[model samples]
Target: MKNCTLDLLGIKDSRLQFDPKYKNKVTTDDFYNHRKARFIHLLQSYPCFCPVCGKKMKRNGFKTVEMVGLPSGGLTNIFSIRKQKYLCPSSAACPKTITKLAEVQDVKANARISQAVKYQAVSKLGQNISQKYIATDFCISSMTVMRFAQGVSTYLKPNQHYLPQNIAFDDFKSGNFSQSGMSIIVMDIATHRTLDIVRSRQNTYLRSYFLQYDRQARWAVQTVTVDLYSPYRAFIHDVFPNALIIADRFHVITQAYRALNQVRIQAMKQAGHGSHNSRALKHYWKLLTKDSAHLDFKHYHKSRNFRNLQLCEQDIVERLLAMSADLRLAYNYYQTLLQAVHQGNPALLEELTQSAAGLPDPVKKTNRTLRKHRQEIKNSFETTFSNGPIEGTNNKIKTIKKTAYGFRNFENFRLRILVELKNSYVSLNFHSA
Candidate 1:
């Protein structure tokens, strides 16, 4: 910025200059708008050529229009352009006679907002700025802001419908609460981007949507990784019969941990809330859920256990383990499942599945559920794919919903998702790879 200059009245004045890139774009200089709403400038176009004859053209009169311009330093600008109109007269060789208005590269024809301003408006959405605020900042109407966002949505839409080899399916709540109370989000597992968001996730809609894909697109899918949700599995079976259904490792392991935590909670309650076992369970729950192989507890000098009065760092876990048989069994089962998954041991998984009969009642419920999908669970170890990336995409969807405070139009909400996939944290090019 230039140093502030003080007039005799003690008001500071400053001068502004255009950047070198934009200097050539403007022929006449800039001035304050008459309404004092923005800084207005006059822009000129290059030499005109006759469209009909492809010969040297004559400049007739000017066609002027107002346009929103790019902003800088918190100051909004407007452009008033006088486009050159060339006359192509009728002749035997070239009979057509017409007047064509010169087009500006930065602004679309008949558009009130410049392309730069429109793009900036859409970019501001990623920063969690509301559309109303962007409109005020750009000196445009809120409707124009929506129009800009819609235009951006159109640009970010996928160009083709080629089937993804590996994909994941998930759902999230959207603006329209009445239609289905939630929306389905389909993701390409490799890119970790949302491919589409539909208003419903029911079987009827899902079948119709996937059926729209050409036969080649459907057949190209080789694997579909999902949680224990039954609908997606059934849909894959019906539509893409050859694809292997792999249950996500994270979801399966999460179920095991949840079941073990239930057993721990039961033990704590039986010991009483204020009792030794209950207190240890409450404070050291993290230690119980953590895998034994990953535990890194260390002993500090002279730190005595509350129960046994002996030096120990894992006193809580030790005390709880000795007090409850069901809790210990559940913990053992949880660890065994995790180990089997990490090692890709189907034999150990089969052994664990058979041993579910002797498990704690709470854990047995989860174990039974896992066994029901044994084949899918086993497929997880054979493939490197999972819903981990899709889960991350869901996290982004939550942020988008929170940023906009919820969307009412599902169409606009869908577009916003496309914007995020193309421009947000990952910056992935779905098919560009």
Candidate 2:
């Protein structure tokens, strides 16, 4: 029976069976060395051919190199490698000699960490995790982790994809540093992806970027939405003549609300020192611009004295709040006007003109701006285009800022944004399946 079992085990070949320990003895070090040898063999299979001559390289020899690895708490694996060098037949023309062995998996030729480790490092970039913590976890030096991060960054730079049919532009102040704090973000509105970010929103910078695109690429853009910034208006008109420029609804409302706030503040300042009225005005300040019907009865009671202030301040504040309701009504009417225009109703123009007349002074100004750019605004409504994606991306930028204690270098900040966007695109594609 034992003979039969042995025969069965050796069915493929008539080899004799032996005790597992006696058959082959291998240590942990031996296995590690074998693994390293296999990795080197795999690399050799894809020879680092000479760029000039395209010839297979020969191993020159081994070189002892010291490189930073994981932090003190982690073990650093320092090992020697066989270097390769290729000799070109034409010594005079070929600047060829012995080539150093290819460092398998390592991002930098002589670096201690591998490309896999570098990629892992990039994944943690901009995360709140400290360099020291990463070093300890990976058993490499902090400097090594940093170098790996830099290597990953270099590899990703060339592969960045920035293709978009429609893009939106907007700017936000970095902080209280006046224009110094302002940075502009250009985004692909359709895909909700950021296209580019610049330190300034100046026309000259935008013009250069616009001109970088060929005529065909420039013409591909159907429309662009931005705020009432005159610089953007001039630049888009000059660069993308075929593209329509629509003022975003959010920008329009933001501007209107800003103006309303200005009026409110001015009115409060002019109200002078009437304790009762000033207190009342202060109490109902937020409620003033909100829908009156949405306000609780207590707010109305608190603000009753504000209604008794001098005619101009009272009238303006009341009028401003009234216009909130009018704005809503106008917004609905505008939607109808949009539908009518799209349907090519003959009386649509007349209806829009009438609607314009019904708007309050502030709203009338906004409508006039729309009318002057009527074709663009109308096209915007007709198409499913908006800067909503860009707005959403802005929140992401803020998150990145918060995650990292705050980036001092705009270049690094921009690169981090690009990396995050690429990662997000990859993640979305993966999850969508």
Candidate 3:
């Protein structure tokens, strides 16, 4: 019976014996008003010597400690253990009578919750679920769950002495937890592991933060992939002198993509509202932006906007481009820019951006923006690194905030992200108190 009880509770300590008086009795408690499986145990372990005098100690009766444990069989389990008390005899070395109570294994002294329950709480915190749900599941307060988070965060802290050779920089909306309403995420490009999260994305803050690492570690960084943010480029130059900046290809292509769409919208306006040509411009805008090489010129289908005329994807795009001269110019430049990026040809990109005359204002503006970051854009073509992984991380951060409805404290928010993202692993032996 004792072995079965010990096995049921997952207790490994042999000194804790189950009391037979309350056998087979599970009751509800008035305090929690929930079904609870209660058990009485006696701690039979005793210390041979007193700590202060190093002399034999005598038993001083027993003291019962009530402890909350992990749920079992859909009911909260509470252990009422009678701890054997010890008393040191008065002597010259130790004049006063000192008493100590035996402590249960896998539980802290004077703590009401068992270490196993805290370990379970820590594991649950690694998931995307919020603290309120975890607290309700474990029948504990949200503050206790936060304490568990704080405990696990100690092991998740990034090492200040190390920096990867290739890193990616990006920022995400961190709510009001940060001073700037944004936070920076530094990621390792090779492993896709998040290196750290900075509370603020300000230049001075980032400069001081990266300067904490050793100069050799900083110098070892070979390349940095970042968005088209100009301040980021300047910051990289000041901190990582040897690091080559690679402007993310996605952001670069986005400039051209938006400009082309703007020109298409202009074509729709010029074609007159409620007209078939305007409707065609609006409906077939996707075909205009799609790769010309992918268009199916062989397959013909009846068009809704062209009086039942049979048109293939290629024909539809050509007709749409014929709406205005500016549209045609912008479409040609957009397609060429897409081809250049796909082929990783920096020279074509340079020539295209340098000679952007007679195009729409939007496309011209995109060209100027591309010219400003010409060198970094060139490095992007030469390097295989991009901000794809970091952008995915940002999406995850946004999802986390969405699920939790946002957090009030920045440190807690950061810790929850680090834990959920698997940035660090927690061990059961760690103390949460």
Candidate 4:
């Protein structure tokens, strides 16, 4: 029974002695609205000699302390321990007296919480829940829960000595965390682990931040995948001299996707409001934006937009395209770009971008963007890397923010994200320190 009680409480200190009549007693905790298990024990280990004078010490008295322990069998465990106190041997020549209390390794000095409980609390912080929820679980205040998390975060700091060979960069809405309201998220492409989250994505801030790493670390990065954010390209080139900046394929495709949609909207407007053509354009927007190759030509159905005309997806799209000459031109460009990207054909994309004349203004702008980052876009097609992992990490950050309703303190927010996402940094026994 004694061994079981020690195991349940995670008490490894051999000096601590359990009471003869000690038993796991469960009682109702009205304040916390839960059941608690109370155990009584005594810590009577005495110091053999005083550190100050190297003389024998004498026992003074026992100091009673109440410490919260890990929950067992759905009940909160509390330890009432009597710690032995000692006084150093007094001498006329030494003229100094020291008093000390025997301490347990599992619990910190003057703290009412055991290290085991703190470890559990820190582990719970990694989950997608608010600190208040963790507080309720441990029957402690929310402030205490935050302190436990902060303590673990001290050891979870990112290792700035090394950087990954392939990395991806992106930003998310920081929501009052930074002055710019946006923060950069760096991720390792190989491991798909979030490397770190910088407080700002501004050019100067990014340059200074990456410069903290040694020249070798910066030069080791080979490829950096990013969206169409103009500042990011400049920042990458300046900091990582050898890294090839790969434009995100999704963003590149989105540029053409958006332009094509704009052309369709214009076509709808030219068709006039409340007209059959305009209504058809509005209704079949998905078909217009969908990849032309995926349209089902075999599946035939009656269409309500064309007097119940017998038509398939291909037939409907072809008929819609015939409504406006500008729509046909934009659709052809978008479909060509989409195919080029999907097929990983950079030559076709280059050809289309080079000769995009007579295209609408929106498409022409997209063509210019493609021309500007032509090499990066080609690198994107050649490499298997993308910003997909960082995008997923951003989604997790959003979930963390939403679960907490929002974070007023950016450090706490960042720590929570790192604790949750960067598992390599957090350890199971971090709180033992």
Q: What is the lDDT of residue 60 in candidate 3?
A: 87
lDDT of 1 by residue, 159-262 (tens): 34577888778776665543667677777777665667766877778888888887888888888887887767677798887788889999899999999889
Better of 2 and 4 by TM-score: 4
Off by over 4 Å in 1: 1-38, 41-64, 81-105, 126-128, 152-161, 175-180, 297-315, 423-433
Which has the higher lDDT value, candidate number 1 or candidate number 2?
A: 1
Deviation from truth (RMSD, Å), model 4: 2.9
* Candidate 4 segments exceeding 4 Å error: 20-49, 52-56, 92-95, 154-156, 422-433
| Number of clashing pairs per prediction, in order | 0, 14, 0, 0
Q: How accurate locally, in lDDT, is each candidate? A: 0.70, 0.53, 0.81, 0.82
The 10-residue segment of model 4 with minimum total lDDT is 422-431
Cα lDDT tens digits, model 2, 1-433, are 6347434322121222222322232111222212211111111223466656666655454343332222221233322233334444445546655344444434466555544555566566546565656655555566666665554343333213233567678886544322557778776677765556766666787687668767777777777877667667877888777777876655644544544455445445655666554555565566455433343433222225545534433343454445345544443444444445445443564456555555555556655664565555555556666667767767777877776667666666666666566534433332343
Candidate order (TM-score): 3, 4, 1, 2
Q: In candidate 1, residue 295 scores what lDDT?
A: 68
Local distance difference test, candidate 2: 0.53
Relative to the true structure, candidate 1 reaches a TM of 0.78
- Model 3 Cα lDDT, one tens digit per residue, 1-433: 9778766876666777765545644455633535344444445555657889888889888887877777777666777777788888778999898888887778877798888888888788767888888777677888898897687666666667778999998989887766788899898887787877888888888999899888888888999998888777777887899999998999988888999999988888887899777899888888987888899999999998888899999888888877789999989988888888889998898889887779899999999998999888889888789999888889888888988888888888877777777632222223332
